[model samples]
Target chain A: MKATREAYGETLVELGREHPEIVVLDADLSSSTMTSKFAKEFPERFFNFGIAEANMMGAAAGLARSGKVPFASTFAVFASGRAYDQVRQSIAYPGFNVKIAASHGGLTVGPDGASHQALEDVALMRVIPGMTVIVPADAEETRQVVRWAAAHDGPVYIRLGRSPVPDVFPQGAKIQPGKASVVKDAKGRGFGEMRPEGERDGLDADVAILANGIMVSKCLEAWEILTAEGIKSVVVDVAFVKPLDEKTLIELAERCGAFVTAEEHSVIGGLGGAVTEFLSENRPCPVVRVGVRDRFGQSGTPEELLVEYGLTPGHVAEAARKAVRLKWAV
Target chain B: MCREVRKNVLIMIGTAGSGHPGGSLSCVEIISTLYFGVMRVKPEDPNWPDRDRFVLSKGHAAPTLYAVLAEKGFFSKDLLPTLRKFGSPLQGHPDAKKTPGVEVSTGSLGQGLSMAVGMALAGKLDRKTYRVWALLGDGECQEGQVWEAAMAASHYKLDNLAAFIDFNGLQIDGRVEEIMNPSPLADKWRAFGWRVLEVDGHDVEALLEAASYASESLGAPTAIIARTVKGKGVSFMEGQREWHGKAPKGEELSRALQEVAKS
Candidate 1:
């Protein structure tokens, strides 16, 4: 198990080695955000902004404008909340090619509590014009997403968490921008054993357990729980929250007619909000959102915090069942 | 050229019917000195890789930038009347994407210096000789991000960067001193590790001299505390807080135009 932030740090060093135009900036949280790894490898290419997140963000925009791909890292709260104006004006407004790789997202940010946890980061980033928001589920996916962001020429906000998570995506798996990865099909076949596009189209599922970030693994557990109850489920990882995989979501809504969006973020405007917002306009389906219910985090272990926030696998399974019932009601 | 720029600025804001003419008039000389005498820029090639960059950090004074860019032939002077209009590239604030020759988008004060620092850092990284200049309002210094950017610039030892604080003592509400004083400006910048210089903001030759000295600095960024009156050229509007955001009317525009056009 490895944290997505760790993968981000490793990938930065790799990208820096390959692309001299790639520069990394951190606001005194380099060690915590894992950007210190890149700083160690390429000292000349790394800039430590020293607790000034806003300056770091604006500077990142400058670097991008000057034809460098700058990856600015800080805690998620500081990146999204503290430096929001800088992000909005300098980076997103100009559509600069800067990557905001924010770490310590959501309730699982451990004991730093509510002040540190960024529940509304995705919402803040997703609302901006031309900002690409991505929440990679695991290490491999994080690697793929980071590589993709480096090559892409626009503003991107990549939400990463503190705690280590189980690897869900297999090695050599590719990430297509604005596309969801179906981790499990209706027949209970996992990502490695999934049937091709045409064959999978005929299968119908009781619920589409759409998830992102660390919650993807919990949704897989929830899938197992639902399967034991004789319910067929399809688990999908919605990595890109901004340019949401509408094609996959439309297909999933048609196939299952029900969705339980799971994310280790706020239910207001994370994966759940994006999914519901999109579906209401396009495919209007019953979606039960399982996440932090408009509450602040507290000092606790990752496990205890997940339980306190009703983000466990049990909560996801229960939400899936409720979504199915709501679908029947409709 | 300065008179021409001042008259153009007056005409644009007067035509727009809504703009910060006071601040725009204040920074005319600073803008003129840099664009005309100091910075090495290619107006025909706005995106020239090696061209010097200028960021208008105090973006409310975009009339000054627009007039100068047009006078410098970055774009047609025909676009001047389109300021603050719908579907116009000249926006309420400086939008780098919309306007040609704008180095970066700015307006939400205090963020421009940070971006300028980023540009200077990038130039150092590429080993390019291009210098970066940013014009900020004295009122904009109250923002914490300005200091943050100042600290970062000095920390990075960006000798290729120079910032001018258009020290217009008025803001939208009242006198800047009465509102939120950012005084002792030169000392403040020095404390932040920048080499501070004081000059009469309206004197083109002095500004040119300061800009030349700034380019020669080796280890740290330079901050020119330009002492200026808010509405510099016009008689009734000069130093008037009410004119900070209000544009001149029909007769007012005529008088302001005559005042600006005079040598």
Candidate 2:
């Protein structure tokens, strides 16, 4: 197991070797955000903004305008909230080719507490008109997401975690922007092919557990629990939260009709909120969210915090059962 | 040329019914000097890679920028009356995407200098010779991000960057001295490691002299503190804080235009 941030740091070095125009900026969190790895290799291209996130964002916009692909890194809380106006005016408004790769997102940023955790970052970035938001699930996915962000032409916000997570996708797995990859399908009998239309006659899953970030592994464990109890379900890794894999979600909604959305973020506007907002309008199915319910985080270990916040496998399984029963009631 | 640009500013804001003319009048010479004398820019190719860049950090004074850009043939002068209109490309503040010749979109104060620093750093990175210029309001220095950018520019040794602060001494509330003073401007910039030059903002020759000095400066970025009057050139509007945001109306506009034309 490796932290997504570790993968982010390593991938940046690889990208620097490939793209000469790529520049890195950090607000005194290079060691934590892992831009330090890239900094070590490309000293001239790396800039430390010395704890000023707002100026860093503005500088990134300038660099982008001058034909440089700048990746500005900081904790998600500061990148999304502290420099929000800078991001809105300097980057998103003009549609600059700047990538905001913020690390240590959500409650997984353990001991730092609520002050550092970005519970509302997804919501803040999502509300911006043209901003693209992504929360990578694990190390392998982070590699693909970082490379994808480097090549993308507009403003992209990548949320990465501080805690180490088990590999969700294989080493060579490729991730598509605005697309969710199905890791496991119904009944331990994965569908070799998917029907784009709502052809539910041969559907086998009772519920779909959609998740991103560290919650993807927890949801996978929940899938195992549901399987042991004679319940069938599918687990989907939703990395891109903004342009949300609506096509895949619509197809999943057609078959299962019930879902449990999970993330290591607030229940308000993270993965769960994005799923419900889209599904309620497009498919209108039952979705039970498994996340921190509108409260501040406190200092603790990642394991202790997950259990305390009701974000473990047991909690996800319970939310899945609740969603299934709600579907039946409907 | 300065008088003509000032006339256009008065005409545009006067027609818009509600726009800033005080700060717009204050920096007329600073912007005109750069557009007409300094800065290597092509009006036909707005996005020419090697062209010098200009960012209006005090975006409320967009009327002045629009007037000067039009005067420089960036766009037609006929579109000046559409300021703050629903479907016009001329937004309340500067939008780089919609408007040609605008390098960065800025209205929220204290952010534009940071962007200029970035552009200067990029020029240094690529070993390009194009310079980046930014015009800021004295009142805009109250924002902490400006200082943050000041530190970055000096730390990066961005000699290709130069900024002009229109020190009109008046803001929306009242005199800048009363509204959280950001005075001792030259010393403040010098302390932040900039090559400081104080000049009379209205004198086109002095402004050009400072611009020339900025181009020759060696290591640090240059800060040209241009002392100016809030509402310059116009007889009735000079140094008046009331004209900071109020547009000239009816006879007031004609008197303002006649005074600018006379100047």
Candidate 3:
């Protein structure tokens, strides 16, 4: 089953019902951000700022000050770029319990073009001190991350994609902030038996594919295709981008000969950059990054943009092949 | 109370040697009138849940807020010399955590008004009659977020919120008109669905009257554009852009203190 990131809205509505302190704030695009359902149910607790992203951030900060847990909604582009200063000073600097639940993150926003697509939101937000950045892989993961964001203290930015992607993880999967989830162990035979002791550690695998958000499904599909060709691979989902799972990442990088990172954002300063910076010092590995290549996107269907920008399973498979060849050549 | 507030502002700015004296002085009467005559507040219980919220939105004018809080007995007036000193609670800006009676930390332009709206909205949700008042800078109106807040206040129908725009007409650069014009300000607020009121900022009686009217008006938020002279009551600094940010030096401090003493 596939799930759209919009499914997080259902979880948010449930969270709001369970917690009276939780408040929802949206720009005019509540429907787009999937927060309108929550708004409809709890109009008193929900605020529609109407196309004013900056004011929403400041207001959310104030709501946090008034002892309300505020979940502010907008597209990733506007949340991170349009009101970066407000988020920095009012929310992040104050260490407020404000959830910046952003939808249409990355190039997946597609047809809305580059202006609306926020390829650098993760990078920009992750750099802020005390900010927790979560990139949920699918709708189920989005729901879980949204719940964690509400429960967690301080500021959090949950990145959600606009398109629906496969549910790689089981339903009700527990997600911990700053912890990466290992969805697939490519070396495991028949998806049940554990890998031999030597390969179990991940070093024997030809390459590891690390991905977040919608790209996780793509990496999984690539893993299946690569396994048939006898190329061993390990698939790890970097659900939490900031305060990244350094322990799991270091272990994976040490065991895997090479790494290929995939995300729906720009190749520069995102999941790929985070992984590269971590591995360079802890465990050096030949890394092949697959994402938007430092260029603005144009109007097109999500599928068209994914293929045009080489973000499909086939692209991940090719990148993995390249990473393996590079590792062996070196 | 007015005399004490003016004296504190003069002393604080004189000691800091780097505070905004003009806007601070311009807002004295409004602060004095609110703290002394208008607001229903407890001097001892600064954070009494039912106490009305006051936000110094034009936070560069911290000296004025500190003076009022001190006069209201939040702290001793003798602490005025610590203004802008190392490790003092009296910073160049009003930090809610550091200062008593400061509802929100605001030094950044165009943000305090939005926070005040949130406070008012919270009051509505909590079913509290406590009102929220915000002081804004006329020069700060150039920020688009101020109008964004203005629109939201109207949309939310925050009748509990009252915003005062210190129409001092001077910023750090020069006259607001020569820098970035915010003229026809009252109509702009009206267009954004606020009940706009014009008043002489330095006239305590008029300001108190307008505050009372805003408190009584229902169905929409009120914006009182208090027209004031920059650096009011200080003859040398009055209406001068140079005095907007600079504090008085030793000789100048003595001279300004003498003028303030007469007032």
Which number leads on DockQ? 1
Residues A227-309, model 1: lDDT tens digits? 99998899999999989988889988889999999999889988999999999999998999999999889989999999999
Number of the predicted model whose lDDT against the real structure is largest: 1
TM-score of each: 0.99, 0.97, 0.91
Winner of 2 and 3 under TM-score: 2
Task: Give the higher-TM-score candidate: 1 or 3.
Answer: 1
Better of 2 and 3 by DockQ: 2
Cα lDDT tens digits, model 3, B25-113, are 99999888888878889878887878888888898999999998887889888888899999998888987767778777778888888
Please give the DockQ score of every candidate, comma-separated. 0.94, 0.90, 0.53
Q: CA lDDT of each candidate?
A: 0.93, 0.91, 0.86
Docking class of 1: high
User: What is the TM-score of chain A, computed separately for every candidate?
Assistant: 0.98, 0.95, 0.94
Task: Please identify model 2 stretches exceeding 4 Å from their true place.
Answer: A189-203
Estimate, for each residue in A56-174, the C-alpha lDDT of model 3 and write its tens digit. Answer: 99889878877789999999999999999889877786587899988889877877798898989999998999999989887777777888788898899998878778786667665
Q: Once model 2 is optimally superposed onto the true structure by TM-score, how far is the C-alpha of residue B130 displaced, in angstroms?
A: 0.7
Q: Give the local distance difference test score of model 3.
A: 0.86
In candidate 2, what fraction of native interface contacts survive? 0.82
- Indicate the residue-level lDDT of B195 in model 2: 96
Position B29, candidate 3: lDDT = 90
For model 1, the local distance difference test gives 0.93
**Candidate 2 Cα deviation (angstroms), residue A131:** 0.6
